[model samples]
Structures are given as structure tokens and as C-alpha cells.
Target chain A: MRYAYYPGCSAHSTARDMHESADAVARLLGIDLVEMKGWSCCGATSAHQTDRVMAASLPAANLLLAKEMGLDTVVTCAACYSRMKTANHEITSSADMRAAVADAVGQPYDGSVKVRHFVEILLEDFGIDKLRKRFKKSLNGLKVASYYGCLLVRPGNVTHFDDPENPTSLDRLVTAMGGESIDWPHKVECCGGGLNLTRTDVAVKLSSSIVEMAAASGADCIAVACPMCQASLDLRQKDIDAATGKKHHMPVLYITQLLGLCLGIPEKELGLSRLMVSPAGVLKALQPASSHQV
Target chain B: MTIKIKKQSGKSLRQTVEEMSGVDMSLCYQCKKCASGCPVTKYTQSPPSEIIRRLHLGAGDELLESDLVWMCLSCETCYGRCPMDINIPAVIDALRSLALEKGSKSPRGDMPLFNRKFLEAVKAYGRSYDLSMIMGYKLGSGSLMQDVEKFPSMLAKGKMAVLPPSGAEKKVVKRIFDRSKQAKGKKK
Candidate 1:
């Protein structure tokens, strides 16, 4: 199946592994990812706070671009998926409000394109059984905590692809790839997004709790859908350890990375080296004799 | 110290905070998940969840006097974890603004001055320059002895860059900042 893809800003920068792993998986699944050209930021936590119109407009513009391309958009990043889905919902459900927003943007938004999260597309379209059939190698005995951060689930109808309170899309995906998924509290908790800029201390504390909880729940690694989530859990873990005087060195992996590994993709191609905590040991435990060179 | 209740406006503190910030303060079930997950709550008397509860109790005057409001790093963990999706960070920010407007002094005297220093740094550079921010904070707080040993290591490791990364359109960022400040001023 062919779908228009929106990688979002983080996919281009810190979380480039997400894009790489996604591309590898799409190729393996025979899915065509046509990237939306000249796309802008999703306006994440900032735009929604400062200006509602701008927030809606940014995602709306991306939707319009996808519509122009004549395909339903599949977003890899959870935050992008949430923003795009929210914009689509608003434009379709509320006519008067949609008209005002369209007027502000000087474009007619007919809400033609459908926004699907990568996980949704995998579950609904690709199916977990198909993923299992495609897996050349299994992630046996790998304990993973499937963390679905706030943006992907909350605000209800906007992102109606899954049960926000108890999302199991990632868990199903992990199981399909032969990994054990752990049930843990703080799975849907916020990683304190852009608040890292204004409140590093707060970000560290919140992120640390998530890691601690995941560890307590017997998770060897935390699997995340958002780049910001990965960043908070991976990059700031050292600071959390320093502040609390406890060592938390859990390797955080993008769900797509795990999928790629299960599909027998080489570790270097998956950009496993880019991660702060090496996923080599984790990968080796998942797949014996899988020495991660480089 | 006896806790004295003051009678004032028709609306309670909870009502006012909810109306202003669009956060349902009563939705906070006091799970203290917010406090438990909070980074800076350990340094404050009242945690974020407690502050929200106080506001819900119509303790507007008393809420304003809280150090909790100023202590919030606005990391948005509370908002992210909240089942109700209440923007707790924004509510805290609103409370801080209200306290400043009402001439309520921070129980921790360094907080207000630290905020001003951050704003001043942002205004001047159109972005946060960490060294300048740290210097400003130290000068404002009168605590230079803190973390002095780590500074050399940080500089050596290139973690503390002397200058911010280039490519920031200073004029455009400045305009955005100015516009937001003006809008905030008008609201005040």
C-alpha cells in the first residue's frame, strides 16, 4: 500500500533513526512512503499554548499538502500524528470554526486527507499476523515497556485511532516481533516536551520517574513513539541519576527500530549507534549471535 | 501561624483560576502523580496537585501567597499525566503572573529575580545563552559557590558553548517575543 508520509521535524534531526527504521520497515512491508514536500513543524506544545489559530493552521497546511498529493497521510511521530489528526477532526467536525481558520490561512480546507499514525497503519492495514510472518528473526526474552506518551492518546476524538487510556497497538506490534511487553504505570505520562527549555529540572524529574517505573516493572528497555519521549528518557537519564544519586541506564528504543531488528535488518543500518545507551546488548539478548559491529 | 480566611470577591479562587486558565482545577484527584513525577516539587512547601486543590477550595488570596506557583518549572508533566488533560503548567504560569501583578512576593526571594534574568537573556539574544543565564542567576541569587567546579569540566567538554548556535533570525524572534510581551501587557 502507498501512503503520503510526514516524518515531522524531529525525524529529520535528533530522531533520524525513526525515519531510517520506518523506511526499512516500509520497504520490507512493500509500503510506499511518499514524503510530503515542504512540510512545516506540527507547532507542538508551543503553538497550541500561544496561538490556537497558528497551531491549527500549521497542521492544516500539511493536511492540505497531503490532499494535494492525493493520498491519506501516515505520520511516524506521535506528536505529528496527534496534531494532524486534531486538525483534520476540527476541520471536518466544526464547519463554522473551520471556515474561520481557512479564512485566516486563505485556503479552502475541505478535509479530504485522512491522518493515520504509523502504529495505526501497521495494526489496521499491515496487521500483526502479517508482521509476524515477515519477521526473519525474533526478539525473544526482550522485556519492553511500550510507552505511549500523552499527545498520541489524549484529547479524545482528535486521535481516535486507539483506546487512549489503554493503548495496546505498540504491545501487539512488540509481541508480533517476538518481544515481551510489560504493563506499567506512567506509560502514558508526559515526558515534559519543550518544557526542557523552560524547566530542565522538572523535565528531568518527570522523565526519571518514567524510567524508574519502567525498571520497577521489569522492563529492560523503554520503547517510545515520540522523539521527544526518546530524548527525555535517553539523553536526560544521566542528569536524573546525578540528581537522585541513582544509576538509570536503561536503553530507550524507537518502536520502529525494534521492528527493523525483528525483520533482520543490520544494527548499523538501524542507526543503533546513534542512541546514547547502546542497544547492542539488548539486541544480542533478543537475537543470539547478533554481534552489533560499529 | 493561624490560617486566616479573607472574604473578598464573589467568585472563589478556584473559580477565578479555572475561568482564566481553562483548566478544571477540581479534576485533579490529588493522586500526587503530578507531585510524585514533579522535578522541582521537593523544593516547595505545596506540590502542584495541592496548589490546584487549594485553588479549587476558593483560596485565591492564599493561593497567591504560595511559593508553589513560582517554583513550577512548567515541565508540563502534570498536564501530560493528567487524565483530564488539565494544563497544570499553564495554570501555574497564570498563578505566577497573578501573584506578580498583585505584588505578592516570592517566599524564595531569588525566584522572581531569576525569572527576570531569564527574560532579559532571552530578550537580548533572542534565545537562551546558557552561560549568560547561569551568570545572571548567580549574580541575582548571590550564590556563586554553587557548581563552580563543574564549570571548567563543562567548558572543556564543549558542553558550554560561549555563543548560541547561529541561524536564529534575531529580528524575527525578537518580533515574536515583543508581540507576545505586548499581548501579555495588554492582558494585564
Candidate 2:
């Protein structure tokens, strides 16, 4: 299958490591992600919180591009995916929004384009059975706390992603990779992705709990699909420890990075070195003395 | 506990917010389900349900001055849990827009400063350039010394793109901003 891929602004900035791993995994999995010639930013929370017209129009510009390409839009960033889905919901539902987006982009938006997340595409479009068959190395019961930041599954009518409260899409993907997907209470916790830079104090208060909850679930590492969550948790991890008086050194890994490991993709190719928190210790403990596939 | 009462001008806060957000304010039954899921309640003065309550009571001035509008995460957790299907985040956005328009002094100036710089970058270039926006935010907010330690490591690890993003249609994006502003002006 093919899609019009949107590499959000974070892919070039804070989430380059995630972009590299996810791109490598997508290629290896035989899904063709065709990027458009000229794609603009989706204007994340800054647009949505401050201005309504901008919130819809920014995503509408990209949706217009995808519609022109005659392919559905696929985005890796959960925030971008949310914006695209929201723009579609607005333009399709209201006539005022439709007129505003049309006047903004200078193009009529009929809202025919479908926005999908990479993880969901892998599970739904690319069959889980096929993905499981390609797993070469055993996870050796490498337990993971599947972390879904808000956008991945929330405001159910907009995203239509999964169960808003108890999303299992990530957990299902982890299980397919021969890894143990642990059920943790904070799996769907909000990490305050929007307030990362401006009001980090608020973000810190929210992100620290996810790390603590992961440890409580007996998981070695946390897997996430959103860059905002990865950046908030991984980048602020040391600070979280310093502030909370906790000695936990949990490595936050992208779902794609974990899948890359199971697919036998080289560590360098997956950009594992770029991760702020090292996963060397966690990967070292992946093997048992018996080397059994249990 | 001290309760503050304030009188609002012509239109009730509920009518204005409902018009801007398209979410019917009367449906909220004060179930407080949204409060249970809100993450930043500890940091803000009001919970999600209480913000709605303030709107119902026509406490516009109180809502504008509170830090709750600035502290929302936009995580949609409250919206997901609300039985009335009220999108508290949307209502908060509307309140924030109203506050910005009214020029109410925000307790947290850095948040609006950051958003303004972020959109300014998008308005200029087709996509957001993180470096320049951060610099503008630092200069504007007078917090230049903050996060200075992370730059060197970020560059060495290829975590940041030093140059501005190209390949997007800048003129088209600029028009989007101009048109949006014009549309808002027309509404007002």
C-alpha cells in the first residue's frame, strides 16, 4: 500500500531519531510512503489554541496537497495526525469552516482526503500476520508499557482511532513483535505535550507519572508513537528524576525503534545513538541464559 | 474558601463562548467527569468542570484573569471523559482567544509569547523554523539563559536543524494567515 506521508516539523527538529527509525521500519515493511513536493507545517497546538481559522487552515493546506496527489495522507507525528483529522471533521461538518479554508488555501476543500497514523496503517493496512511473520529475532519477553499520548486516541469523533480510555492498538502491535505488552494504568495518561516549552512546569508534573507508572508495571522500557511524548519524557527524564528524588532511568523508545530491533535492522540505521537516554542496558537484558523464544 | 463575584458586560459568557465554539453550554450537567481526567488541575486554579461553571455564571472577568486558560494541555482527556460531550479544550481555546483580543494581562506571559512567535515563524516561512522561533521567544520573553546548555549536545547529536525549512510553498502559507486574520476581522 502507498500513502502521502507528512513528516511534521518535529521530524526535522526534536524527533529526528524517531523519524529515522520509523522511516527505516516503513521501508523494511514494504509500505511505500510518498512525500509530496511542497508540504507546509500543520501548526500544532500554537495554531489550535490561539486561532480557530489558522487551526483549520494550516492542516487544510496539506489536505489539499494530499487530495491533489490522489492518495490518502499518512502522518507519523500524532499531533499532525490529530490536526489533519480535525481539519477534515470541520470542513466536512460546517459550511463556515469550509468557506474559511477555501478562502485561505485558495482551493475548495471537499474533505475527501483521509488522514491516517503510521502505526494504525501498519496494523490495519499492512496485516499484523504479515508483520509477525517478518520478525526475525525474539523479544525474549521484553515487557513494554505501551504509551498513547492524547492525540492518538481522544475526542473519539475526530480521530476515530481506538478506545479513547483503553487504546489497544499499540499493545497489539507490541504483541505482534514478540514482546510482552503490559497493561499499565497510566498508558493513556496526558503528558501535556503542548506546554513542553512554554509552561514546562505543568508538563513535568504530568510526564513524571507515566515514568513512575511504567516502573510499577514491571516494564523495562516505555514505547510511544508520539514525538511530543518521547521528547517530554526522554528529554526531561533527568530533570524529572532530579525534581522527584527518584533514581529511575527508564528509556523511552519509539514503537518504530523497538520494531526495528525485532526486524534485525542495525542499531546505527535506526539512529539509536541519537536517543538521549541510552537503551544499551535494556537491550542487554533482552536475552536469557537459555536463549529460548519464550 | 473565598468566593468572588463579578458582573459581566452585555452578552453572557455562555452565549459568546457557545457562538465561538459551537458547543452548547447548557448541556453540561456539572457531572465533574472532566475534572477527574484533567491532568493540569493541580497547576491551575480551576478544574475543567469549574471553567464551564464560571462560563455558566457569566464570570468573564474571572475566567480571563485566571491561569487556567493558559495552563490547558489540549490533551483531550477531559473531552474524552465528559458525559455531556463538551469539548472543554475548545471552550478553553475560545476563552483564550477572547482574552487575547480583550488584552487581559495573562499571568503567564511566556505561553502567549511562545505561541505568537511560533505562528510568526509559520507566517513568514511555510513551515516553522525551531531555532529562530526559540531565539525570538528568548529575546521577547527575556529568558535567554534558559535551556542554553542543551544546544551543543543537540547540534552534535543532529537533534536540531540549523537552517530554515525549505520546499514548502511560502506564499500560499502566508495567504492562509492573512485570510484567517481577515475572516476573524469580518466576524468581529
Candidate 3:
């Protein structure tokens, strides 16, 4: 299967690991991810709040580009997927909005291209059973909390792939990769997103709750889909600890990275080190030899 | 003491909450999982579960003035723990928006000031510049003297950049702002 890919801004910069793991996983699954060239930012939390039209238009432009390529677009970032899906929904549903958006971008948005999350591509297109068969190293003992932030699931009409309220796609993916998934509160919480900059105290407080809950649930690490979610939880973890005076630091990993590791991809290549909290211990714990050797 | 049975206005608070949040408020089966997991509820007059229960019982007007709306960090703990998947944060956001529309001031004194400072920071800079945001918050909040020590370190570590990053597309961003304002005006 081939997909026109939208990596969004974070994938190009801070969350480059998502791109790496996604590319690796795509290659392993024999799916072609041709990136949409010269794509701009998706106007995530900031854009939508500041300007709804631009938020929808920016992602809609990318969709127009994808339609030009004549293939469905797959977005790696949850925010990007949400924005694009929202834009797609708006354009397809409202003729006036579509015409206005098309005029703004100087391209006709025929609403032909479909926006898909990488998770959807993995589960629906690639199939979990097929993924399970390819896992060389099973994450047998690793307890992972599947953290699906707000974007991927909410506004269910646009996303449409999973149960917005009780999403099991990521959990299913983790289980297929041979890891035990933990039930934890804040799995679908907003990881404070761009609100990190505007409201540092609130962001820290919010993220701390998630990390604390994950630790309490016996999760060694939390797996996530959105780059922003990973950054807010993983990068600001130290700040969260400082604010809350809690020592809990559960490592945050991309679902693709977990899948890549289970499929026997090297940790360094997947950019695992980029995380503030190292997943080496978690990875070691998952390996069978570490159990007997320790 | 008998709790006074006030006559409900006959509208389902669950439906109202769902309409505002895009979350099915009916999913909350009064498990109190949300209350158990909530961080801010400890600091608020009402816990998250109670807030939902009140909303479920058509206590819509009461929620408009409740301190619980402003206190919500939008952490989404209730949404995650809710077996029925109720998005408490969104419901809170909706309530806060409603309060803002109704000209209801934040009872917790610092919160409204914080909101104004935040919007000022955003309005000045296309994107939020941390230094400006912090300085604005401190000045507006009268907490400048308290956090004086941390400011210098934040600057040294590059955590707080001097200038805000320009919006990705400034012209377009301005247009969005203007249009949204116009949209709001039209709604009014």
C-alpha cells in the first residue's frame, strides 16, 4: 500500500524520531510513504484557537496537494491528523467553506483525498495479526500504558477510525507487539499541548498527574502517538517532578518506536535516546535474557 | 438534615454537558473514578464527580457560577478513567466559555487575571513568548517579587526566549483573528 505522507512540523524538528520509526515501519510493512513536498505547518492547538479558518485551510492545502498526488494522505502526528481530518470534514461538508478555503489556498479542494493516522494505517491497512507475525523480539514483560491524547480520538465525526471515548487501537497495537497494556487514568488527557508555554504551572500539574497515574498502574513506560504528547510528557517530565515534588518518571515512547523495537529495529536508529527519560531500562526489562540474568 | 429538593427545569444536564463538550456525559455512571483521579478537585469546592452529577441533574445555571469550572486544568483525568468516556475537561471548557459569555467573573481571583494576561501575551505576539507571558502574569498577578530569582535562570538556560516566534503565516493569522472576532460579533 502507498500513502502520501504528511509529517507535520514536529516530525521535521523535535519529533524526528516519529518520522524515522514511521519510515522504518512502512518499509517493514512494504507500504510506500511518499511525503507531500513543501507541506506547511498544520496549525495545531495554536492555530485552531487563534484562527479556525487558517487552521482548517493550512491542512486543507496539504490535502489538496495529496489529491494532486492521487493517493490518500497518512499523517504521523496526532495533531496534524486531527487538524487535517477536521479540515477535510469541514471542506467536504460545507460547500461555501470549501469554496472559500479553496480560494484562499489557490487550489481546488475536491475533497477526494482521505486523511489517515499512522495508527489506522497500521491496524486497518497492515493488520495487527500480520504485524504480530513479524515481531522477532516480543515485549513480553513490559507493561505499557497506551496514552491517546485528545486530538486522535475527539470530535469523533472527523476521526471516525476508533471509539473516541474508549479507544483501543493503540492498546491493540501494543498487545500485538507482545507488551502488556495497563489501564490508567489520563490515557486520553490533553498533555497540555502548546498550553505548556502559556500556562507552565497548569501544564506541569496536568502532565504530572498522567505520569503519576501511569506509575501507580504499574506501567514501566507510557506509549503515545502524538509528538506533542511525547514532548509534553517526556521533555517536561523533569519540570513536572520539580513542581509536584514527585520522583516518578515513566519513560514515554512513540507507538511506532515500540513496534519498531518489537520488530527488532535498533534503538539508536529509532531515535530512542532523544527522549529525556531513557527507555533502555524498559527495553532491557522487555528482553527475556534480562529477566534470568538479573 | 434533609437536602432541599429544588425543582429541576426539566432539561437533562447530561445532554447540555454533552452538547458543550462533544463528550457523552451520560457515560459517567457515578463511579467517582474521576473524583479519585482528579488533582484539582482537592483544591476546589466541588469534586469532578459531583460536578458531573450536578450537571447530570440539570444544574446548568448553577454550574455557570461554580468555582469548579475555572479550577479545571483540562487535564482530562475524568475522560480517561471514565468507563463511559465522559470528557470532563471539555465540559469544563464549555462551562468556562459560557461563564465568559455570561460575564461571570472567576471567583478565584487570580484566574481571571491570569486569563487576561495570557490573552494579552498572545495578542501582542502572534505566538506566546514565555518571557512576555511570565512577565505579564507576574505584573498582572502582583507576584513579580516572588518569582524574581527564577527569571534570571530561565533566561540563562534559554528556556525563555526574548522574542515571540512570529506566527507561521502572520497575515493569515491576523485574518483568522479578525474573522473569528467578526464571527463572534455576528453570533452576539
Candidate topping TM-score: 2
Q: Residue A129 in candidate 2 has what lDDT?
A: 80
The stretch of ten residues in a row with the least summed lDDT in candidate 3 chain B is B1-10
lDDT of 2 by residue, B86-151 (tens): 878889889888888788885574688888888988887788888998899889887787768778
Q: Write model 3 residue lDDT over B43-162, tens digit each, in one string.
A: 567888887777666675656677677666544556656777666765776666556656776554355555555445444543444466557767776667653654554344333456
Which runs of model 2 end up more than 4 angstroms from their true locations?
A: A285-294
Please, what are the lDDT tens digits per residue for candidate 3 over residues A8-33? 65564457678888888788879999
Alpha-carbon error at A12 in model 3, in Å? 2.4
Fraction of native contacts under 8 Å reproduced by each candidate: 0.03, 0.82, 0.03
Which segments of candidate 1 are over 4 A away from where they belong?
A: A90-96, A110-112, A288-294, B1-188
B48-150: candidate 1 lDDT, tens digit per residue: 8778766655575767877667556444556656767777865775676566667786545456655566555544653345577668777766667665765
For model 3 chain A, the run of ten residues with the poorest summed lDDT: A285-294
TM-score of chain A of each: 0.94, 0.96, 0.95
Q: Is candidate 1 or candidate 3 better by TM-score?
A: 1
Candidate 1 chain B weakest ten by summed lDDT:
B164-173
Query: Taking the tens digit of each residue's C-alpha lDDT, what string does model 1 give over A97-135?
Result: 477457545577866589888888888888887777777
